[model samples]
Target: MNKPQIRAHGLLDLLRLVAAWLFYSSTIFFHGSYLSPLLVHGYPEAGSLAIYGYMGVNLFFLISGFVIAWSAEGRNWTEFAAARFARLYPGFLVCMTASFVVQTLAANPTLPYDPSTWAANLFIVAPAFNRPFVDGVYWSIVLEIVFYGWVAIALFFGVFSRWKLQLGAAWLLMSVLNESVVHSTALQMVFITQYAPYFAGGIIAQHIVAKGSSTEALLLLAAAFLLSCKEVTAGADWMQAHFGFSPPLSSLLAANVIVYALFGGALLLRRRIAPTPLVLVLGGLTYPLYLLHQKIGTLWLNALSPAVGRWVALAIVLTALLSASFVISFFIEKPIRKPLISLLLPRLNMMASKLRLDRPA
Candidate 1:
């Protein structure tokens, strides 16, 4: 029964930075191919921390749901669609291009761009074209797009204006079925079934935090956490099947518990932090950091290891990659988003106006 109260939230923004740092350190420090040369020399295996780091994507989905719901207040379906597009696509295009260029040049890159795969990935859903993502990290982007699509549909139908909790609860129930019962690839693809709990968690968080607290939101929040806990076991099975190795189930469970705690605890303390521009910018850096950190950071490590020694190389590379992401967030993404919104919002408003269902009752 609660409506979204959109506002700038500093604590949530800072938590996003934490998730980004977790994933970034896991990627760069663990020394996969981008880092193997340095890692092979002496870096310790991140072990359980690396496994836990995988759940950072879950945190991202949760935060995104919260952000979208908050941002959706007072906006028409068309305007919502435009804002989401401008927020994501321009930076994605630039980062993908940069990733492609870097991967092509790296000696042992994982995301070598085949023209077809690269082209398909430009849209963030290469699977739709029957191709793999240009980089492994892209699967999250696909899930995000799918989430946006469903929300946009709700907007089109004009129900999202008043039905946020009902829709979130419904999605959470379906996600529970998808995780516990029949495992359907179709369900997973369209509904983002495996990851729905996290998204639902964000939605629940939004309802609780933005609209003031309520019992319904609390119960759904508990359900979402339980479902996410279930995913830890499933994720272990997945890793074993594909990668020929699996971390201990206890380790996986512990990691999930820790992340859910961190995320949930942070949300609980949202008002304790001040909403500052620097914190907000740190939040903005997460997207570019996520995009740039993986293969590129590793590539830098590989190139630098013998010349600088692994540890020193890691320090330099981490500093540089983090700075690059900061620069992209501050200069590229921010500057472009403002102009893009001005140009696109009017057109989207027109499109949504034509949809009879989109009109407010």
Candidate 2:
């Protein structure tokens, strides 16, 4: 129950959001030819440089673990679920719809809209439904949902608070074994074994804030870093194999290490972080910006590049995305959320309560 006192500037959250935009945006830079003029003839460097941005996603997972664990305190499963849904789904639905529209309308569309795929993306499980995401970012949102599911299950079992450290530690170790020994798709899906170390680091961060000495946090942080390093190495291998750029494995590891260190250091210095209403607005824009950026932003880049120069076109698109995200956050998403929460939450609470009651003594 010892969460931050709701200050003005979430230094860490802002940091995570920036990393998300930087890394993911860079990936788009390489994967597509939006900035072809800026790249060398073969675009070799772009691929390797963009690979490091993948760590930004891991940074997000770590932050989510910490924030979710901190937020879940002093709430029943109903409250937790409702809060998460209200915060995530309303904004997501708005952005996803916008993304669908923009991508569908683009002159040379990247993902041709299949009605089934768009519908599946509405549930954030396009692949499971044998369809594709309208936007690629939905994959990470799916992981966050899976993590939330496990956390909810833990809450229901009444083990989250009492056994968090042990649970997190075991999850980290399982990730190691899962990668090396089994390579089971089922295990990966169920536990999110690939990203568990980051989540585990988040949980351990909460423990550091709430209970443990800095030394303990440091030790657990070391374990998570070592495990996460393996994933980074694998990513390097994958990038080399598929993308044809062998970014020095050492550079990739160093970049990932810096990301982990920044996150851990933020936890240690979390007190200095101020939380303002602006934090919510910045946080709000991040998701919408992320959702709308890839397909549409690139379209904008392509469309405007002929008229304007490439870098100028890129700037225009970035500005447009930021403006669009702000509009979605304040005008559409925030307005829709209250009504949505009001309509669905009571029913959700009743169902969760019934489930809680039905549990055998």
**Total colliding residue pairs, candidate 2:** 7
Q: lDDT per residue, candidate 1, 95-192, as tens digits?
A: 87787777776644444457886788877887788876655677788788888888888877778757878988899888878777878889988998
Candidate 1 structure lDDT = 0.75
- Provide C-alpha RMSD values for all models, in order: 3.2, 3.4
Best by lDDT: 1
Identify the candidate with maximal TM-score. Answer: 1
Candidate 1: pairs in clash = 34-298
Clashing pairs for predicted structure model 2, backbone only? 7-275, 7-276, 8-275, 8-276, 9-274, 9-275, 9-276
What is each predicted model's overall lDDT from 0 to 1?
A: 0.75, 0.74
lDDT over C-alpha atoms for residue 125 of model 1? 82
